[model samples]
Target: MSQSFSLRTKSFLAGLVLPLLLGACESSVSVRGNFPDPEEVSSLEKGVHTRRDVADRLGSPSTLSTFQDQVWYYIGEKVEKTAFYDPVVLDRTVLIVKFSSDGMLEESHAYALEDGRVIDPVTRETPTEGQDLTIIQQLLGNLGKFNPGGNK
Candidate 1:
């Protein structure tokens, strides 16, 4: 009702609302993102180099597959957040380098998220007969409980 009281209330509301609007604007302006180029990876010529040479050129790969020991893989993913809350996957890159039996670079390739997944995600559950069995249980199961010809 009083003019002074109304002015104080308006000042308080202004202080509160201004910061909120500023924060919203700041958040809207703030952003995070990344990009990777496949061309950053060097090429491997058939006769130019060996594994060591390739390593010397492109550092060590991120991973190696057990089934294909000769193959080396590099995979990376990036997640970006806006205003420190909304998370998004900005980009991803996969580089694969295959080696020959002699440990030389056999083949090399680079991939992007837009390229899509090479392997499809299988949702069908596999009937797993594999169960956790203790070593004692395994041994006892192997031994007959009541062997008629037992040399007990």
Candidate 2:
């Protein structure tokens, strides 16, 4: 084979091997998150089960309502991704289970990121005191408005 033909063959083989090599080099991901099912939470009957039983079946409640001792909140968040390259949270499922004071299941709600866009806790519009600056003032903000040329 000609040198050019051999080079082309090697290039083509390398192209095929590139993805496989990268894929092999990737770190193995252990799915570190688990989210409970809303329906499974609903199956739990608060009136029927005691605290011990509740804990045994549903694992542990995430938070207990401060004001309401009876209200037990079981919150779970799970984020799944396709690849480690970007590490995107491709799928997010949240299950919030509320149990009554008597140890009965009161409410079971689930939320999926697929249902809506991610919400930012912080607001983009920040409140500033005093008057708003104009284009020139805002542009030359640090320079200040005092100019010797403008003096009478």
Candidate 3:
């Protein structure tokens, strides 16, 4: 009888612990973008590595400079998310590779999450030269526009 009770207790404990263990495994982590390895980054020799060499070594950059193409940006981000919660950024890397006018690598810079800054975007709306109509107004305006005769 004791042996049966012990088996039943172990089974009951395992049933409770299994769900908790599964629940704890809900966290999902994801890494996005082609982040270059440290060795690949180190292989770049300033002034010797041209645009082509850099591209061949590290792959195409995530993006180029906004206005000028002299600077290349390789961005990578790691995020973690769990059930019903907002994703949290676990890591972020922004590799800035600058080139001279002759297309030779001038310098390289790496920035991490701590180096980032938050900028509040401008919220003011740009007024356009058009009347804003309601849903009913839009529906009524479109009603007569289509010909019921199916004219081509």
Instruction: Name the best candidate (by TM-score).
Output: 3
lDDT of each: 0.70, 0.64, 0.94
Better of 1 and 3 by TM-score: 3
lDDT: the better of candidates 2 and 3: 3
lDDT of 1 by residue, 26-127 (tens): 533322232223444555686557878766666667778888678877777776545657756666777787888888667877787798756878899868
**Regions more than 4 Å wrong, model 2:** 1-21, 24-33, 37-39, 66-69, 77-86, 114-117, 120-152
| lDDT of predicted model 1 | 0.70
Assess the local accuracy of residue 62 in candidate 2 as a C-alpha lDDT between 0 and 100. Answer: 70
- Order of all candidates by lDDT, from best down to worst? 3, 1, 2
lDDT score, candidate 3, position 51: 96
Cα lDDT tens digits, model 2, 1-152, are 69999999999999999999888656543343445555665676646766676677677677766887565565444433444454545456655556675666666566677666767687588788898789988878867567868977
Order by TM-score, highest first:
3, 1, 2
lDDT of 3 at 23: 94
Model 3: what TM-score? 0.65
Q: List the residue pairs that clash in candidate 2.
A: 46-104, 46-105, 70-101
Overall local distance difference test of candidate 3 = 0.94
